[model samples]
Target: MIRDKSFYKFFVILVISLAFQNLLVYGVNLADNLMLGAYSEKALSGSALCNQIQFLLQMLVVGAGEGAVVLGSQYWGKKDLKPIPHIIGVTLRFGVGIAAILFVIVFVAPTQVLGILTNDQIVIAEGVKYLRIICFTYIIFTTTNILTASLRAVGIVAIGYLVSAATLCINICLNTCLIFGNFGFPELGIEGAAYATLVSRCVELLIVIFYLKYREHQLNLTLKKLLFIDTSYVKDYIRVSLPVLLNQAQWGIAQMIQTAILGHLGAAAIAANSIAVIVFQVISVAAYGAASAAGITVGKTIGENNIEKLHEIVHTLQIIFLGIGIISGTLIFLVSSPILEVYHISAEAKVLAKQFMCVLAVTTVGTAYQMACDNGIIRGGGDTSFSMKMNLISMWGIIVPLSAIAAFVIKTPPVVVFALLKSDQIYKILPVVIHLRKWNWVKKVTRAEI
Candidate 1:
């Protein structure tokens, strides 16, 4: 059943779809940085801090989506249509609830939320404005992503890519027009960026709805069915998905602390770190895409009862990912100077950014292996709970304490502190490599649905 050409076809399509989606999503981020950075450094730092909450919430939704994929891919592989609705229903239920809670918290207590991330009054005030306006976008974002993740589960990756690209283009155009009053547009500045995001999210939701109606014929999803509470599937989804949600949420929290540390370091540090992060994320699109594709492919293989091919597929992917890790790391290093040149940041910030970029480029080599295998191959084999534990252990246990010390106690340079903060990637490599040899990860998750 696992033909080389056919698998490659699936691999390439999903990789492109997911990679392009990352490019578009992060490209909008780059635009935000450009527009906001040009507007004011304090504003840029403010928005960056506010977006941390967004990142935290997105991780929760993505965790739910990952649950959908884990179940949906297996069902799709088994050619069973019955369980798809239940899995999606559970995912949507969680996504909607999280989005609503996030919206209320950000909208009602904007300053309170912003205050937690940064100590600067200017950044807090600016971030409050962005948070209040951007809160409205969370619901649509969460729901749309759940739907798209389910689609990706069934090998329908293009729609998400197209939808994201279209929305990002709109977001950037609106950002340009509104942020600077270009083409006779009002110069809303910070408010303008928030409005652009709000408008783009609205369009993104509508486009996703349209795609589901016209293109997702096989899923045959209805508003009633998606909203219908399947207690059984909800339980099952939680049983498997909670760890992932916690893994991401906890990881997000720890990462937030790292952000807070950087935020406190100075506005220059925030801007420099922000630029470096955006660039690294762009380069990382390929690895992330491959990870998702591998998950889907391995999940399908497991459901179809192709154990031998499953092993073969994973082993091959490991080698390929390691190679990608090396090349991507090298590539980021080679181009760092040019990339930094394009940014309008100060000489000081650029100097800091280049140093951090060096650490990122080097760490990406380890990242490729750890992320691809951890999120992809192992979890696809129905071992998410273990994956979750691994993350918690690595991040909270090791990354957090060391980062605190690096930033607080050692009082080292920003780049060295950053390198210490990112040491988790290096630390995780050994554990992941060891775990891959074990047989416990290959459990079949597609028993008859309740």
Candidate 2:
């Protein structure tokens, strides 16, 4: 129903850029998965387990950055640029501290940590080898993500995809040469994959720095600005950001738990789950991009006090989200078989993976709609606590417990347990729809002066 041409233009640009950027980021992981899968099934399983830790770190760092974006976008809306640097500073301090802590833990107890995910000694050993090298990229990745998020809050999204493209290319080429020992290079196997990712992280950081220093003019950010944050904004930042942090952390931990449940099933289950997840992650980029764009748009809209257009915007976005969900689901369903064929896993693993993807294909529709609505519209409007509460209830209270019971007690099929784990995407729709109608999620997070 929305008729504004400029709105469509802005939304389209942001969605395409952010989606491509996300695609490239996942493309790096896809490269790792593909290369490792070809090397050996053991190598792929081990690296997949190690990547779970990386995924957890990503969630935490992204949670921190998103908190800043929520605030920064509002400030950017008012054309008030002074407080944003402080917001970035607050974000960096928390983000880096988290990265450092995780690095120490991972470096200190690589085997013990991987043990929590699966009991397979072979898989754990492979994971440990990959973890030792890949863990080093944590801090570097965090810094780049937070910086990129700062740009995104102000509607500058092209840099993110561009940097990711460079990283993807570097990762793929290195993975090819190092993983296979091609062109006289020493074959590092799983170790080579870890090294390739580590190098890509460093290069990604450099690219982000170059762009910030030379290309970006709005914030004119300096090392000084990052080092000396206004302490006054710390409390405000925590107040708005803590819930989001906890939400993401809990969500990340929940995913690990899900992995652990499936990991206990067998190596085939672990390998299958990993393959299915990568495909879903790649194809769902558009859905995620829509959520990110929605957050920025809704946050900026509230900051501008353009409440009049809010209803139209939300309605129109819902339609777009539904369409995106259908297309994403179809793509996942169509590509599931061909993608499975590329993996050098057992036939049993391939069959299980296909089943998982089928489940994801159906759940993705609910995910696209509910994720965009909750994350983009509600949380983006400054009601961060809602999602925190909703996730706690749905994930912990319902999905996790039921899935655990199904997987362990009832001895359900792996596919059934996975469906239970993802059922939140569907059941949450009613509550989210009800809450959106109430309109209480709209709150201006910006202050008169910092």
Clashes per candidate (backbone, < 3 Å): 0, 0
lDDT on C-alpha atoms for all candidate structures: 0.84, 0.93
lDDT of 1 at 400: 72
lDDT of 2 at 390: 92
RMSD of 1: 1.7
lDDT of 1 by residue, 1-450 (tens): 335887777787888889889788878777888788888787888888877888888888888899889888888889986888888888888889988988888888888877776678888888888888888889988988899898888888878888888888998999999988999999988889999998888888898888887777888888887877566777778876887888878877877888888877777888888888888888988888889989999899988989888877888889878888998898889888988766667788899989988999989988988989999998887888776788778777787788778887988788887898887777788888889888678877676642
Error of 2 at 259 (Å): 0.3
TM-score of each: 0.97, 0.99
Weakest 10 consecutive residues of candidate 2 by summed lDDT = 441-450
